[model samples]
Target: MTSLERVSISIEKRLLTRLEKLIKSSRYTNRSEFIRDMIRSKLVEQDWANERREVIGTITLIYDHHRRELSEKLTDIQHDHHDEVLASTHVHIAHDRCAEMIMVKGRVDRVRALADRLHREKGVLHAELSMSATGDSLR
Candidate 1:
């Protein structure tokens, strides 16, 4: 087990009240777990802010597969970044629509660029990049 430490800080009453409400609404049994998650979230954000840092992310895209040449274009884009893309899955949402989720692991800039390219393709109805980390520093 990892060693544990205790610390305390002061906050404004209003902010503290808001934190309490958030904890209760989220059904957290206590404040420590909530604070730990808040810290982890900020750390992940910091990791992605450094462009050279290794990161992981998923790019989700929804598009109309019936659009002329759209599927081929998307496939070409993925192949262009094949080294960085870990895996991908495609689902047929309907006769005309499809959804794709591409898992990527690479430097922040490369991942972001790949996501942008996928999102900018003409037939993409929606795209979202969910950023995460390699988990080397969470401890």
Candidate 2:
């Protein structure tokens, strides 16, 4: 386990009250835990901002499967980024719709580019990329 440190911060009374309200609404037991998590979240985001940083994330896409050649196009795109894609799961949502969840591990820029390519394709209804770190620095 990493060493822990205790510190104190001073804030305006109203700011402290607002922070307490937020902490309660979020169901955090204490302000220290909430602040720690917030810092960790920001750190993860910063790690991904570096292009060379290796990261893991998921891409979720919803599209019309019945659209002309859309399924084939999507598969082709995935194949093009085979090195970065760890796994993918596809599900049929309706007669014409499908959803795919793609797990990817690669450099930040490469992963973001692949997701952007998939999201920009025709017939895609929605696409979302969830960013996360490999935890090399967060110990």
Candidate 3:
């Protein structure tokens, strides 16, 4: 484990109260860990905002399997960017609906482009891109 350092900061009473409430609601054991995680989250966001930085994330998509050529188009797009697509899983949500999650790691711009391509498909009912860190910046 890394050595620990103690630091202090001043904040308005109202903001401190809100921070405590957030910690309780988030089920964090204490403020220190919560603050550490919050900083890490900010770091990940910064990494994603810089297009040239390599990052990791996932793209989730929901679509209608009955839509003609929709699956083929999605597959083709994934194949075209095979280097960025680390893994993928597909689920049959219902008779006509399907869900897919693709894990990706690459330059931020490339990952965003892949997500946008998937999101713009004709049959895509919903899509979300979840940004994350490649862990190199976290530690």
What's the lDDT for all of these models?
Answer: 0.94, 0.93, 0.96
| TM-score (C-alpha) between model 2 and the true structure | 0.93
- What does candidate 1's lDDT look like per residue over 17-60, in tens digits? 99999999999998999999999999999999999999998999
Candidate 1 residue pairs that clash: none
**TM-score of each predicted structure versus truth:** 0.95, 0.93, 0.98
Q: Judging by TM-score, tell me the better candidate of 2 and 3.
A: 3
Give the Cα RMSD of candidate 3: 0.7
Model 1 TM-score, 2 decimals:
0.95
Best by lDDT: 3
Can you tell me which runs of candidate 3 are displaced by over 4 Å? Answer: none
| Model 2 per-residue lDDT tens digits across residues 3-101 | 889998989999999999999999999888999988989989998879999999999999998899998898999999998999999999899899999
- Stretches of model 1 off by over 4 angstroms after superposition: none
RMSD, one per candidate, in order:
1.0, 1.3, 0.7
The predicted structure with the larger TM-score, 1 or 2, is 1
Alpha carbon lDDT at 1, candidate 3: 92
> Could you tell me the TM-score of candidate 3?
0.98
Model 3, total clashes: 0
Residue 121's lDDT within candidate 2 is: 95
